[model samples]
Target: MEKDNFDEIIRRSIAIRKKYHELEMTHHGSEWTVEEDALAYLTDAGLVGRDIMSQQLRWPKVGSEAELEHKLGENIWWLIVLAERSGIDIKDAVHNFLDKTETVLK
Candidate 1:
């Protein structure tokens, strides 16, 4: 199996987001919005899934379960983007929260 590396993972995540933009160009080009993206990550990715969710309830899913799971990683990238856009270092924030949780549990 391949080893997991955070830097590489982030790079791959960015690439995945880029592909979303490209696909949107041919499909949802004009209708795409940041709120749509955020909501997609929040609801669709959280519910129907970032992987297999369709553009509509009536349409069939385009991929398999494992492919859908892999795409879910993009949701993490979404939060990372939001944090950066808001001038926060999410890595430090998550570490701080974990440290606080550990202390509370002890």
Candidate 2:
């Protein structure tokens, strides 16, 4: 993806998380704890796996490609939120991981 597009994704992801945080604050008395966020992410991640399995017919077909696409995006959103909550610069972290992994593989 283009740099600009990646930046937009980060921006929008944070904005969406902030909206949820606001709701959590209103209903739960505080925003989600990091552990809670991780659990939620894991739940969605599991759904992604299930969706992929269904698409591949490894399991009973339970969801469509559109559901898989949505879960994938939600996982990305969760990653962004997690990184942000941990005070890590996600873009730089991704770049560094890719660089190191590529060098090792090469």
Candidate 3:
């Protein structure tokens, strides 16, 4: 994707996170801690894993691909939120990971 498209996605993700945070604070009386967010991410990851297994096993009615995509997106959203809470820029973190992976692979 183009840089502009990636940036737009990031902007939208940030907006979504802001809205979620507002609702969470309003209803739950506080922002989620890193640990709480991590648990949510893990839960979604487990769902994704289950979906994958079901697909592999040729289950009669596996979870929809859209469901898996939604869970993965939620995982990414929580990861971004956690990084932001820790004072890290999500874009920079992604780039750093890519750079490190490239170096390690070479």
Candidate 4:
């Protein structure tokens, strides 16, 4: 994707996180804890895994590509939020991974 698209995705993810935090504060009296966010992130990851399996099995009602993409995006959002909470720069982490992979591949 283009830099613009990636930046937009990050912007949208942050916005969604902010909205969820607001809703949680309104209904639950506080925002979600890091642990809660991690658990939710794992749950979404599991759903994505299930979707992949269903697609591999050619299930009649498997999640569509768009649905999978959305789930993956949500997972990314959760990961970014979790990293931020943990005082990690997710962009740096991603770059590190990419750099390592590139070195190994080359």
Best by lDDT: 2
Scored by lDDT, model 3 comes in at 0.78
Tens-digit lDDT string for candidate 3 (15-94)? 88788879999999997777887788788888878766666775444555768678777887777777877889888999
What do the candidate models score in CA lDDT, each in turn? Answer: 0.66, 0.93, 0.78, 0.83
- Residue 50 lDDT in candidate 4: 71
| Model 3 regions lying over 4 Å from their true place | 1-4, 58-61
**Could you list the CA RMSD of all candidates, in the order they appear?**
6.3, 2.3, 2.8, 2.6
Better of 3 and 4 by TM-score: 4
Worst 10 residues of 1 by lDDT: 48-57
Q: What is the C-alpha lDDT profile of model 2 across 2-91, one tens digit per residue?
A: 555888889999999999999999999999999999999999999999999989988787556889999998999999999999999999
**True lDDT of residue 48, candidate 1:** 39
Per-residue CA lDDT of candidate 4, range 1-106, in tens? 5455655766776788899999999999999999999999999999788777667776545455667788887888888888878888778889999999999999
- lDDT at residue 66 of model 2 (Cα atoms): 89
What TM-score does model 2 achieve against the real structure?
0.91
Best by TM-score: 2
Model 1 lDDT vs. the true structure?
0.66
If candidate 1 were superposed on the true structure by all CA atoms, what would the RMSD be?
A: 6.3
Q: How do the residues 1-106 of candidate 1 rate in per-residue lDDT, one tens digit apiece?
A: 8976866765666577678778888796663566766776687456434344454444466654655565566567887665654567777888999999999999
* Cα error of candidate 4 at position 17, Å: 0.8
Candidate 1: where are CA atoms >4 Å away?
48-74, 84-87
